[model samples]
Target: MTTAYWCVLIAIFLPYLATGAAKFFGAGYGPQANSDPRAFLAGLQGWRRRANNAQQNAFEVTPAFAAAVLIAHQVGVAEQLLLDQLAVAFVVSRLLYFVCYLADWGPLRSLVWAFGMAMIVALFVVSA
Candidate 1:
């Protein structure tokens, strides 16, 4: 598989990783844990809340990213290197986005998100 294909795989699971972190940090393990998962998520504060938000954002971006990858492959884009570069940019920006969220870097996080979105857009543009 190509590097872009591998990036798609990572993007697929990234949200779950963020969600797991939220669950761990917000509710934790053991008998004392909240029985209601929704309640547990609702009660998240500070970094945990940010983590959950990041998880949601991860999910939100995934469909577009996946579709772009599929479309690019189906269309047989001439620039394989460009496609791979955009894929890497998307993954890296997303990772930084998650970290920025956890760190509460509001403006910087938004920029990172825009950068990731731009990467997705570039994928489609290149495919066209």
Candidate 2:
């Protein structure tokens, strides 16, 4: 498979990784863990809350990214190298976004999020 295809695979699971990290960081495991997962998440603070927010953000961006990839492929975009590079940029930006969110780097996280969105937009633009 192409690197772009592999990027799509990684994108598919990225949100789950964030969600798992949120749960782990929020202390949602072990014998004393709360039975209500929703309550557990709702009570999170600081970095844990940021992790959950990142998880939600990941979910929010995923469909757009996936659609861009699929549409770009179907429309036969001639710039394979550009498509691959943008795909990689999107994935890397997302990973950095997650880190920035968890680390509470508000401005940097916003910049990373914008970068990821830009990558997706570039995919569609290049394909068109």
Q: Work out how many backbone clashes candidate 1 has.
A: 0
Candidate 2 lDDT, tens digit per residue, 1-128? 77788899899899888878878754456555546766666678888878878888888898899899988999988988888999999999999999999899999999999999999999999988
How much does candidate 1 score in TM-score? Answer: 0.92
Best candidate, lDDT-wise?
Answer: 1
Clashes of 2: 0
Residue 123 displacement in candidate 2 (angstroms): 0.4
TM-scores of all candidate predictions against the true structure: 0.92, 0.91
Clashing pairs in 1: none
Q: Residues 1-128, candidate 1, lDDT per residue (tens digit)? A: 88899999999999887777888754464455546766676677888888889988999999999899889989999988888999999999999999999999999999999999999999999888
For model 2 the TM-score comes to: 0.91
